[model samples]
Target: MTDHTPSSRSAARATRPVRTKALSALVHGICLSLLVGTVAPAWAQFKASPAVSPRIPGNRSLSTELKIEGMQATTDYILAVVNQEPITHTDVDKRVARITDTAPAGSRLPPPEELRQQVLDALIDEKVQISHAKTIGMDISDQELDASIENIAAQNQMTLEDLRNRMQSDGLDFQRYRNSLREQMLLQRLRDREVNSRIQITEDELTTFMKEDPAAQAEVALNVAHILIAVPEKATQVQVAALLSKAQAIQERAAQGANFAQLAKDNSADTKTKDQGGALGLRPASRLPELFVATTTKLKVGQVAPVVRSNAGFHIIKLIERENSAQATYTQQRARHILLRTSPQQPAREQIDRMNDIRKQIVGGQTSFAQMARQYSEDGSGARGGDLGWAAPGQFVPEFEKALTALQPGQISEPVVSRYGVHLIQLIERREVQLTEQQQREAARSVLRERRFEPTYEEWARELRAAAWIEMRDAP
Candidate 1:
């Protein structure tokens, strides 16, 4: 949903008099969760990390008289319990709106009871995960929270006061909304620690996946868009026939030049792509569903594949574009750095001071970059005169990359603090390289990681649910 322009939100509040209806409109209609794309691995999948959505159509409500049994309940109403943390009806409503918002604009909602149950379950799972984060002492600092809130407001093209005022008029508490944003960031960090860090593609596994299998080595990423005609898990012959006919009709319409995205949004049952007009994004063939890869591989760009059936549903796919993985160009840098990792004993300021001194020494000719790195640096590269042979784009984290990219071929960087430590980076040279044999294996490792990300994340989420103590309260 597009953000509420100040004028529009003001108009909404003025016409409604009280904020309840306007807030619901915000929750169910225009308001959105904070998410923009980060660099995802080249795989066609849902971009939004599926978290329980929290949308209370208007500003956070503190009203006493406006209580509607289940829907208008306050902070005290317990809808479910996860690890003894109370999940309120308001929480469930917000999440339900969030979930429904992700669905195609006109997609049919589940029965209310069913939708509520699903939202409750998702919230419980989320609560347990959040509880685990707290138990481990993972926290968002005030500075970090403030920055994230600012980012969210910027993304919505609003100032912080503008967002707060809009929420205020709708009866949504601005502070609680900020808390929600912080939790979203926390969940992301928790998953990066628990799920992403755990998905390791070992050298042996990568080698076998690439070299041992001739086919895997030649795998490519395809840009595929698909419209799904969903068939229920079980159906009679009559239901099957109806679905197949519907799928065929949609295919013929797309073949005849109807807007595929609009067609998919209006008709497709695949929730992930329904709103996207059926864009699956780019997916490595190896990671794609076997049926999808096989069917679409035979077609050229702009050609529609025949409707393919699986247990879930019928897929009508269009081949958008394809790229050869072998043709991937990689930028490589020969760099080195002197590191001073901050510890409880050595604070960040001390580390920065030390690196600044080291840089001064290098400039004064008292020591070379390599000599200083060996004597004062705290990394494995210190042994090699601070030479990082050749590194690729994603080989370093974003902080380090930003620092590295700012250096000239022979220049020294001011001390930069990354997660690993404080570093004074020096660039020796940079060059573009084709995928060498070694690089191919590394690329294959990335492919394996991409393949495993969704499934691994799903498994981790499932484990979180399974391990939690959940008690469902009777429906209000």
Candidate 2:
């Protein structure tokens, strides 16, 4: 995903609500558990390493022979051993190279030695976790591993062959890459099994949590769209005036019932969201900028806010949707889908084409959506004509929720691919309803569980590390 950080040109560029890194990483085919401080390299969170010129040597693992795109081959030797598994110097080097290469622009780097130590520690943790997983008989089936690779390819909008070729071109060995993914999968499953099971929130604890953090109980989520008219840093007063006038005109058009999305597509200076009709998606008030939340808080759905000036530019804001816990109300969506799970025999593209054909039949009136769904959908809901029932926000995965949210009531979505499978979704309807006491408590519990997860996982990992047999070796 492109960094949403503001550029030197404008702070408005950074005004887009931040998405959770896990979801973003998943969408981009990076391992999700890596974002949550799992065994994988914490590249995004860690500082980069200084450049190093590696010397090629005879003693190297087959995996280390595949050098990263701009990095030279390095001598490989044992750096550490965990449960009889060797963590090599090349292993640490490759991770450091990746971190250096992909670290966000303008990020600082730690001393080379310090960064290497961090990478080595992460590798040791991974080896320990993988060993534990094997000891516990936790293994990824071949079919499951294949499915994961296929999902990654699909998420990247590539065929399996394309993904393979891309990896090869980037100096990555296909088998080694597969092995790495398998290890990540094992580590994630192990953490979920060992860590998630340990977290228990009682009813009284939930009540206390909600009472202490009332804002959590009465959270407000907003879906806001904006059209930005950027003013350059060195702009004269005349230039600023011109941009402000342009913003005001756009705001007027939006207020008078012009299509905000269309206006955004035509004129919004914010590149990241303009393509998506300027919507930043539904996010908590805390996630959005203070100025934006404050501006749109009082606006009814579909209402527009007046032109506002900021350091970045002039903005024309529109309220798309709002869910307020204070009002004890939230929007619920009733959607149905025709799902076709992908397999090695059935490629994602073929399944997608099949779904498209099904969509065509439904849209052409040759068959009803429900009829097609009942006849062909592979999901459990197929028997019920693909009905998913009424669901509130976050009831579905991120990709599914995004597709569902984009559809108007009674409108059918184009085939959407999620981790589950390809889906042909139709939004039946949406309603705003009051939250029941039971639902409120459940929500509180959910929040508390998430809050507790990181600390619990860290403690669990520390215990595992302490118990593992580890030995440090001299660098050759």
TM-score each candidate.
0.56, 0.67
Q: What is the lDDT for 147 in model 2?
A: 81
In model 1, what is the error at residue 334, expressed in angstroms?
A: 16
How big is the positional error of residue 67 in model 1, measured in Å on the Cα after superposition?
Answer: 24
lDDT of 1 by residue, 282-372 (tens): 6557646678888986798888877888755787899888866577655678888877765545655566767888899898889799889
Each prediction's whole-model lDDT (CA): 0.63, 0.68
User: Which candidate tops TM-score?
Assistant: 2
Against the hidden true structure, what lDDT does model 2 obtain?
0.68
